[model samples]
Target: MPSSLSGRTVLVTGATSGIGYESARQLSERGATVLVHGRTPEEARAATDRLIAAAGADAARLRPVSADFARLEDVERLAEAVVRDHPRLHALVNNAAMAAPERHTLTEDGNEIAFQVNFLAHYLLTNLLEPALTSEPGGRVVNVSSSLHRAAAIQWNDPQRIRRYSRLAAYAQSQLALTVFAADPRVTAVSVDPGICATGLLPLYGHEGMPAAEGAAHVVHLCDPSTEIVNGAYYDRSTRVAPAAAATDDRTVKRLTKLADLLVGHTA
Candidate 1:
């Protein structure tokens, strides 16, 4: 791990708000070049400006990128742009996520909205950007997973939950898949439950929570080269912890990868 982040480059998804936004700001201030992702180009640019104005972040260190996670095509385009421009990406903070809606809604891509946005989209994007994610020792992926995953199970036969739907269940399933993804051998990655934070997903947690920065700190910690990490490991804040039993199961990771590839129309 390098003592300084000056030469590193990190891409943070969902950087318009919450923990994602704070993570981008903190990383930029630490001297790392950050690609701030949002759902739209306007939103991405606005977030970049806000970081400069409010956090005194260096404008030169922030790059704005956009993609609507609900659309797999958009994710592919986003990956193409990143791989073409940043050939040696140092880290990827897979922080973009959305709660399942009250009703079972499906995207035009024909998958549950939350499932596509929260997990499948990242799954596709990461695979597409493989050429860019550096193979260097400190390079890795950080999945902003949730503790709620402990209570959820992957509805394998009906991943979209077409017959039965619970917003909380849907959200939890997505988080669980993300945790399981860290175990993927294709990439060196780790998942973390940033703790309950007062972000857009706070309602799912059932109470007021800590500031977003506090949660972002846990995420940013893992991004630092100084922090040692084990691929497939899960964390509760700064502590290494076991996640749901299924999250570490080899069969689960392989199964989820196959399912995600099918859902997203991806080959690998």
Candidate 2:
């Protein structure tokens, strides 16, 4: 393990693979105790094992928590467990998201699949974890967003996409909103676009992008407080990037905050 983040407890969602896996790996190797979160128990277990091995079990610490983000109830429950168990959370990396390929599908809670999984669930998770974030001195909430947010469609009144769904629009809007909201007090929230990353998210566009490790580097940078300065700034790779027009608007932030309050409701 390297240094700087020694003894810190970090939680990373979507640790099963891709950017989440790499961020967990790098953080763990650098002496932070990583809480590896995944939707499935089996996959979470596998990711935990890989991270422990990659960073050396004694050198790296890990905790596995599983919850399906598509279901808000599960996210709330997961948030409860983490808060009760780990109060001094140092970093929260909200890297879990889904990109729907076709017309919007409803989630278990009757919300749009892309919006529910990409933004709302993450928002719920972060709000639930806010105490832990502010408990210590402060914490970082790094949201893995994308550059496509420039063309995002924020159908604020209809996150369920009841009107109609453009797959890319759904994805971009959700990411943009997520990054924007993470910039709350005592939380250094930043969204970073893993530009054209070679993940499972691009089947609709017929494009596969850069290697997952290459795309994950900036996420790790966000976790490392040394490279952290601009509290709510969006990042592209390592450089700072601007969010969408909506992401920079206070009206949208207030609306999203209210929606989050109504949605989370201390359930967990």
Candidate 3:
């Protein structure tokens, strides 16, 4: 094991498979105590087993947690549990997100599924876990976003795409909102474009991408304490690049943050 991340703790969401799993594995191997999160207990356990297999003697550093992002209540519970269990979190990898659904689906929270899962749930979780993250020096929050966000507009009046629905549109919008949210000066946050990887989410685009490990590398780099990357910047596979115009607009960021707080039922 590298011991590069020794003594640090990182929570990687969506660790059951693909980039998320690979990210968790890489982090664990690098000596970070990794919390592997999945949508179900079974999935979480399976991911933990895989991570352990990869970590060998360092396997003890991997733990499992599950939460269904489609449900706001479940997201809330997950946040509360993390806050209660890990008081000195060093990093949070908000990597759990689904490809666009075939149709517009609404979560139990009455918000669009993509918006809630990809953006709002993370919005709530980061705020809830802010204390643990800020308590330690060099705390980092890595949000796995996409280059697809370049095509997105907030659609503020119809943020949910309730009137019209397209999987790509919804996914792009959600990613854009997340990137904008990362711009907040309060958190050491950075949004990453994992570069199209051969993950299950790629099938939605009717094609395969690079290997999942390649995509995970982008995330692992950002989490490394040695990286001198600027906070609140967007990166395209290790190279910082300009994000969509909306992501840089201060008014838009604040509006989206306020809207996200309202949607998540949180104040301030």
Residue pairs with backbone atoms closer than 3 Å in model 3 (clashes):
none
TM-score: which candidate is best?
1
Ranking by lDDT: 1, 3, 2
The 0-to-1 C-alpha lDDT of every candidate, in the order given, reads 0.92, 0.78, 0.87
lDDT, candidate 1, 143-237, per-residue tens: 99999999999999999999999999999999999999999988789999999999999999878999999999899999998888999999999
Clashes of 2: 0
Clashing pairs in 1: none
Best-fitting candidate, measured by lDDT?
1
Q: Backbone clashes per model, in order?
A: 0, 0, 0
lDDT of 2 at 160: 69
**Ten contiguous residues minimizing lDDT sum, candidate 2:** 259-268
Candidate 2, pairs of clashing residues: none
Sorted by TM-score, highest first, which candidate order results? 1, 3, 2
TM-score of each: 0.98, 0.91, 0.96
What are the RMSD figures for all models against the true structure?
1.4, 2.4, 1.6
Using TM-score as the yardstick, the better of models 1 and 2 is 1
True-structure lDDT of candidate 1: 0.92
